[model samples]
Target: MFIDEVKIYVKGGDGGDGCVSFRRERFIPRGGPNGGDGGNGGDVIIRANKKIDTLLDITSKVKFIAEDGGKGQNRNKNGKNGRDLVINVPKGTLIKDLKSGRIIKDLKENDEAIIIARGGRRGRGNAYFKSPTNQTPRFAEEGRNGRDRWLSLELKLIADVGIIGLPNAGKSTFLSRISSARPKIADYPFTTLQPQLGIVDLENYKRLVFADIPGLIEGAHSGSGLGNTFLKHIERTRVVVHLIDISAADLLETYNLVRNELALFSSKLSKKSEIVAINKSDILDTETSQIIAEELSKKISKPVHLVSAVSGNNVKDLIKAAADLINKESEEDLLRLSLPDDYDAISNKGLTF
Candidate 1:
C-alpha cells in the first residue's frame, strides 16, 4: 500500500471573540472598562519527516483543522491562543494548490516545514477606550477569519540510480543480487507492484542508492501497463540501468519500446545515460549472447554488457561499470555543490546529481 499522491483539505483556526466588561470591584467606586482582548488563532503547517516513507497515513484522512482560540476573560485578561496543527509527511513531498495546479512548496529536507494556512487575528477589547471626552466606551474590534486551502501532495522517491526495463527483465533479480533488497521474483509480468530502494556498497566505503521501478510495457506512457504511475520515482536518479532479458525474441524492439516510453514521459528521463545490460546470459550460449549484445550496442551506439542474474556470470563487471559511472557523476555533483552561490554561471555548466 504505497501511496505517492493524495489530496487534502486544510484549514486554520478562527480567532476568539473579545470581551466587553467593566470592572465591578467592591472597593472601587467607579471602575473603567476592564474587558480582556481575544487571543490569536492557530496556524496549519506541514513538516517533512525523514522517518516517514509513505503517504498512506496521510491519505487515510481527508481534512485537517487547527484549534480555535479561547474567548477573552474579564479583568483585562487576554484569551489563550489556539494550538497549531502540524502534519508530518515524507521527504520529497510537494505541496500544490489543487485548484490552480501550482506547486507551492517542495519539502525536501528533514524537519522542513511550511505554513499552509494562517491563523486569524484577535480582536481588541474595550479596556483602552477611556478618555477625557468619552468616559465609558463599549466598542470592540472583531476577530478576523483564518485562511483555508485545498492542497495536493505528491511524493517522489529519492535515489541515485534507476533500474528500468520491460517486465521479467531481471530488474528485481539484479537489485536483489546487488543490494539487500529482496523484491518478489516470479516468471510473470508486473512482479514489482511498488518501487523499491536499495543501497549498494562499493570500494572504500562508497555507496550508491538504486531505485527499482515497476516494469514498463509498450504504451506505458499512454496509460497502458501501470500507466507511468511510478515513472516519477526515477526523475531524480542520476543514472539509469537498462536491463533486458536476452532471451526475448525481439530484443531490439523491447529496447526501443522502453526508450520511446521514456521519451514520451519526459525528455529529462530519456536523456539520462544508460548502462545497457543483457541479462539472462546463463540460459543463452556465449555466441548467441555476444551476438545479441553486439547488435544492441550497434543499434543504440553504446557498450552493452552481458550478465546472468541466476548464475552471477559477469554480474560483477556490470555492477562495476555502473559504479564507475556513479562515482564520476557523484564527483561532479560534489563540485557543483561546493561552489559559492555567487558562482551561478560556473555552477550551471556542471551536471546535476
Candidate 2:
C-alpha cells in the first residue's frame, strides 16, 4: 500500500549513571576516589532511502526509541554509549515538529539524514568532586533526560515530469504507453488512486522520470476530488505535462479549470514550465484535432502538442519535448521551494479515499 503521510513519536536514549567507588589495595596506604563517568546516550535520526517510494513501512510502527547508555563501572571504567536509532523514509520525505509545526528537515537526496532528537548528557562521577581541600567527596550528579517530540512525515514523489489533468484525460494511458508503470485505467474518473512513477528511456541513453497524479475537478483546492489530495505529490517535479481530452466539448474550459486548480493549490505549481498536450486524438479526425489544438493553444498562449496515447501517434515527440524541458530544469534543485505558509497543516488532515 502507498502511504504518503504519517505521524510518529520519537525519543532519544537516556544517559547512564555515574559510578562511585574508592581505590582499595594492599600495597597502597592511601586510596583516592576511583569512580568513573557515565556514558552518553544515543540519538534518534531520520534518513532518506531512494529504494523506498512510500511511507508505508514507517506507519506500521508509531513509536521509536533509541537504546539507553550503560552505567559506569568500578575501576574508572566508563559506561558504553547507547546505539543510535535510524528510521528510513523515502527520498522526498519532509519531517516537521508536530506541536510547533516547524519544518525540521527536508530529505531530498538519497542517504541524507537529520537528527530529530538529541541524547542526554552523561553524569559525572564522585571523583570529579574530589579536590585538595575536600578529600573523599561523596557527591555524584545524575544523568540528564533525553529529548522527545511528535514528528510528522510527509512524502512527495520526486520526478522529472508530472502528468496532470482532469479525470479521464488519458494521463494514465499516456504514462502506460511510454513507461512500464501499470496503473489502473478505466473509462471512469479517478481511476488512478495514487501517484505512479515511470522511467521513460529515450534515444542516446537519456532517461526521464514521469509521475502520474490523480485527476482534478473544480474546488480541488478545498478537497473536492482526488486531485486535491494528491496534488502535493507533484510539488517536486521539474516540469508538468498538462493532458487535456481533445474530444471533450468544452476543451478550453476544462484546461482552464485544471490550471486554476493548480494555481489555487500552489502558485509555484502554476508558474512551473508546462507543456499542453491534447490527448485522445485517435478518436477525433485530422481537421477536428487541429482545430481543437489550435484553439486551446491560442487560449492558453502556449505551444499545444497533439498526441494520441492509445494509437501512440506523436507520443514519442511529446516525450522527447518533455524530456528536453526536464533536462534543462534538472540542472537546478529538484526539491520543492519552501512555501511561505506552513503546509504541514494540510498534510496532517490526511488524504481521503
lDDT, candidate 2, 22-107, per-residue tens: 88899986688878878888999999877677788887899999888777776788888889999998888888899999988888
Q: Considering every candidate listed, which one attains the maximal lDDT? A: 2
Candidate 2: Cα lDDT at 72: 74
Global CA lDDT of candidate 2, please? 0.81
* Model 1 lDDT per residue over 76-132, tens place: 998899899999988778889999999898787789999999888888778856689
lDDT of 1 at 242: 93
Off-target runs (Cα >4 Å) in candidate 2 are 27-30, 330-353
Give the Cα lDDT of each candidate: 0.80, 0.81
Number of the top candidate by TM-score? 2
